[model samples]
Target: MLDLIASLLADKELDCRLDHPITEARAAFNRAIAEKKTGPIKRLLVEDAVLVTGTDSGVISGRDAQVEVWRADFAQAGRFVYVRTPRCVLPSEEEPIVTELGTWVGKPEKADGSEVRGDYTAKWREVEGKWKLEAEIFTTVKSRDALAL
Candidate 1:
């Protein structure tokens, strides 16, 4: 499962279908929740959730607070679990420098005629031989160019 998760993370660059990764991530997270293995860092969306954005004037202070932002986004959007993980690099390899941790930027046209571009990241740990997301976050990025329609 860890290997699958790793592949899914890299698939963003490979241009592979993201649905598989999202599905797997969702199932893995659900299982973790069911088994009560998500740890203190993770909680259901209803318990806490919010959305942080640059232009929206909303902000999530810290790590746990960011989780709430992610929860809200996931709830408002579809429920497929999508995560953009850290790219690991060997000493001889160069890594991509992302401004934020576990941040993924994607924009799919919304029916309302607004572009939603955001970055998301997930923290995962090996628990009981399976990788579970301990923390996850989403931050919205706003731009006049992006919003121009």
Candidate 2:
């Protein structure tokens, strides 16, 4: 009984420690997007990070390429808002890899006043004590009728 209690306490402590870094990473990402600061976004990504977006069909590989895409998007965008919430955060036991399944909503500064909602899975790696995004795959949420052939 004592062993079980101690194990449970240790697990809880581990969870607490994991939450801080994950939450901070997410907050930093949101801030970067909101402020339109590509530098902060690049700092959060690994050199060979992969980004697959719902807007485009092509996969963006490498941090420099990803930043270039964001630069173009940011240039065309005005008064935009992007928000994401993590639904699940899974930390790997064998490697320093963490995967987060989340929902993202974006409202572009457009005349149509449309909002884009999607689900994303982001893989992060702890590089030199800092969590950096390694890869991300996004899937847009569409209506049933839209999927109908």
Candidate 3:
């Protein structure tokens, strides 16, 4: 019984150890987006990260392309707020990768006060002992008003 208890405790400890860095990376990414800090956001992403935006926006391949798109968007945004809550952080059974599925809401600083709520899935890769976003895809949840229109 003591050995079993010890084994359980060790498993729990391992889980926490693996999860801590991913949680930190997620927080840092969200903070960068909320503060519109381009440098931090770029740093959190892999050099070849891919970002797919909703609303008919085409796939943005490569980190530089993604950064440029965000730069333009942030420039016009008076105040931008982005929120993401991870529904699941699943670790790959075979690879050094994790996938996160989350709900996200973004309110751009627009005079009309438009908001976008959606679900996003992101793939994170452990690169040199750091978790970096490798790719992300977002889909918007249409509001009742949008459906009516």
Candidate 4:
């Protein structure tokens, strides 16, 4: 699952980039939704996912659309680093599950030191002897300026 995610990040797939490991994504998404904050930024820590992020003001106004805007902005950024944490194996013996945590960091094209951040968790399922992303959830941590936008 991690390998597939790495490929997507490398290719910069705007949609369905984190679809692998579906369980983790869905868990994170559900948690964020439960937080129900007024701002567009909301987050949750799944069983094995960690959140590390930074963002610009563009996210605040988009509300539910923040993720969409981030994807577009990510492509426009000049300097960016996407980092992934090592995959972890769950303790339960019922199924073979893998969990991974990762983040995407982006620097503005013109600014000297402005940037955006995205953190995510991906879970993979071994279905029919294949590992694929079953769930994912992610959030962008933005700066005051980005939130204001």
Identify the candidate with maximal lDDT: 2
Worst 10 residues of 3 by lDDT: 12-21
Q: What would the per-residue lDDT of candidate 1 be over residues 1-149, giving only the tens digit for each residue?
A: 33454576577564323332333544554454333343332532222333344335565555466555445555554222332443331111232211113333333323334344445544343344443344445655542243466
Better of 2 and 3 by TM-score: 2
Indicate the residue-level lDDT of 94 in model 4: 63
Put down candidate 4 lDDT per residue, 53-145, tens digits, no spaces: 233322132223444444454455353433333233332246676555565444444555556556666555565554544444555754324
TM-score for model 2?
0.77
Positional deviation of residue 95's Cα in model 2 after best superposition, in angstroms: 1.1
Please list the residue runs of candidate 1 whose C-alpha ends up more than 4 Å from where it truly belongs after superposition. Answer: 1-23, 26-110, 143-148
Q: Please list the Cα RMSD from the true structure of every candidate, rounded to 1 decimal place.
A: 10.5, 7.8, 8.2, 13.0
Number of the predicted model whose TM-score against the real structure is largest: 2
Per-model CA lDDT versus the true structure: 0.40, 0.75, 0.73, 0.43
Query: How do the residues 15-66 of candidate 2 rate in per-residue lDDT, one tens digit apiece?
Result: 3133647767978988887777899889999999998876674699999998
Global Cα lDDT for candidate 1: 0.40
Better of 3 and 4 by TM-score: 3
Task: Tell me the spans in candidate 3 whose CA falls farther than 4 Å from its real position.
Answer: 1-20, 77-80, 110-113, 143-149
TM-score of each: 0.33, 0.77, 0.76, 0.34
